[model samples]
Target: MDGHRCPGEDVTVSVLATVARFLARSAYEIPEKDLRIPLERITTAPPSGFVVSGFAVPPADRSAEDQHPA
Candidate 1:
């Protein structure tokens, strides 16, 4: 290891990009609620974990390979 770069960094970035793309195209609604994170907690997070509803996956976003499996 010549530098601090991780061997799986490229794979990690690719996976994250794929996930972001999927989420961007997907349709969903997050209910209105107090999403404030309390500073007192060590692991900061919303009091009630993020809640999503009315999710609808668009057929047009699916790739041809996904629509027809080998």
Candidate 2:
């Protein structure tokens, strides 16, 4: 019952674990200097929440306070 086969069972924990494993693998492959997860990120609502599986970020919503602040 490995991570690859866990998705077939449709178990929530297993699915989450598989996702974590995939993220871990990605972290391992990518250089640390290139990785960035903002410490200020908040997932309570839109614009800052996670995106997945071809869900596009709408063009009008801006997460930060300013787009081109000086």
Candidate 3:
């Protein structure tokens, strides 16, 4: 129903937020050659898919507080 929230909404939101945060803090590079997207397609997406290289999560960016909450 429109008035009621889906039971899985909270979990889905949490998972998405966690993933977004992880991605935001991660260091990665997308090659310029891989930036091509086909606008003619109904779903405009990269032909080779979104590719990234040298992906890493810097230890400095992650603090002990983030790993252990008080």
Q: How well does each candidate superpose onto the true structure, as a TM-score?
A: 0.73, 0.28, 0.60
**Tens digits of lDDT, candidate 2, 20-58:** 755554422222242345557663344444433433333
lDDT of each: 0.87, 0.48, 0.82
- Model 1 C-alpha lDDT per residue in residues 1-70, reported as the tens digit of each score: 5869988999999999988887888899999999999999889999999998988776775565598888
Question: Which candidate number has the best lDDT?
Answer: 1
Name the weakest run of 10 consecutive residues (lDDT summed) in model 3.
56-65
Candidate 2 minimal-lDDT segment of 10 residues: 26-35
Total clashing pairs in model 1: 0
Model 2 local distance difference test score: 0.48
The residue pairs in collision within model 1 are none
Residue 68 of model 1 has an lDDT of 86
Error of 3 at 25 (Å): 1.2
Candidate 3 residue pairs in backbone clash: none
Query: lDDT value for candidate 1?
Result: 0.87
